[model samples]
Target: MFPIRDHNPSGRVPYVTYTLLAVNIAVFLFYWFSLPSDFALAKFYYTWGVVPAWLMQGEGYSGLITHMFLHGGWMHLAGNMLFLWIFGDNLEDQMGHVGYLLFYLACGVLAALLQVAGDPSFDGPLIGASGAIAGVLGGYLVLFPRAKVDVLFIFVIFFRVFSISAWIVLGIWFAVQSFNGYAATDDGVAYLAHIGGFIAGAVLVLPVLMRRGGAGFWARNQGKPPHPAAEYPVTPSRIPRVPRR
Candidate 1:
């Protein structure tokens, strides 16, 4: 199942979220076009992407932040951006632009540190905004546990969309990451980083939630968006129907 959208609407324009999306895309495109060859691109990634071994050696420390903007492929970038777009706005609305930006960066840094802790000797480049986006998912869960998120589920040839609560969707995601982090033998994906970032995001957002009245806030809003849900026009199916005898 993949999330398509959420029912939560931000009270204000999420300028910071939009800016982050633009910057990530621009950075990816710049590297894609400017790098002379695949080898050159790999070299670039090694230089900028988080390499735990190098970081442990007190080198490439800047990569903790830089690596968040670098993606390994188009699909990687697309998936990260989609998650950021969906969950980021609401968080930003609650935290304010400056606070949210700092929160995002802090989560990324903590995530990189956790990944390094997981395998400090590994030299492979760890790159992607997934850790940071995972943080957003965590924050979203804390603030909007009952918010509706539309997920598209595909099983074999059958496909359908289901609206699920944020708690269910994010809870399952966190569980999967934890399970994979324990089960995987090779240090391929940074599941540890995802777990770390999620925890950090949830922890960091606590003060903000408390200021907003905590349980009282939930009681008032019921974890729904503060604004009216956006209206989406329904379109009639265009596929030709077969007549039945």
Candidate 2:
């Protein structure tokens, strides 16, 4: 399942989100050509991506920051960008451009540390903007629990888009990540980073949320947007073609 868009639109263009995307793209381009040799690319990731053991050994501490821009593959990059584009604008709107940038960096670092706490001895380099984008999801959930997020759910031959409350979607996402964390013994995913970043986003947004007048913000905005919503043209489903059986 994937999110196409959300009914809640931001009041302004999210400069921070756009800049984040650009930076990720640029960093990927710099390393895209280095993937022909797995060992070479792995070395690059080891130097830039978060390596729990190295950090614990008091080295390569910069990966806590650089790792957020490194992604494992195209699908990984696309998925992270989609979530950031959908949920990030709202948080950026609330926090403003500069504030959101710092907030994002902080979440990325904290999430890496949390991943270390989950398995400090693992040598695999954790890469992807997922942890930071997961943070944005966290902030969005807390600030607008009532907002509508349209998610695409697919089960084999079936595909459906459902509009649900933000809380329900994000809450379930967090639960699944945590469950995966508990179930996996090693290296399948950095699910704990996702959980940690989410918690960080929720906690970090508290001050910004309160400054906006706590419940009064919801009262004025109806927990939605103050302007017309952004519409994503619904995709038409294709009926499977079969010979007259």
Best by lDDT: 1
- lDDT tens readout by residue for model 2, 175-231: 989888888846567898998899999999999889989889878877765557667
* lDDT score for candidate 2 against the true structure: 0.87
Point out the worst 10-residue segment of candidate 1 by lDDT: 225-234
Once fitted onto the true fold, the runs of candidate 1 whose alpha carbons sit more than 4 angstroms away are: 185-187, 239-243
Q: lDDT scores for all predictions?
A: 0.91, 0.87
User: Which stretch of 10 consecutive residues in model 2 shows the poorest summed lDDT?
Assistant: 223-232
Q: What is the TM-score of each candidate against the true structure?
A: 0.95, 0.91
User: By TM-score, how accurate is candidate 2?
Assistant: 0.91
Show how many residue pairs clash in every candidate, following the order shown: 0, 0
Q: Which candidate has the highest TM-score of all? A: 1
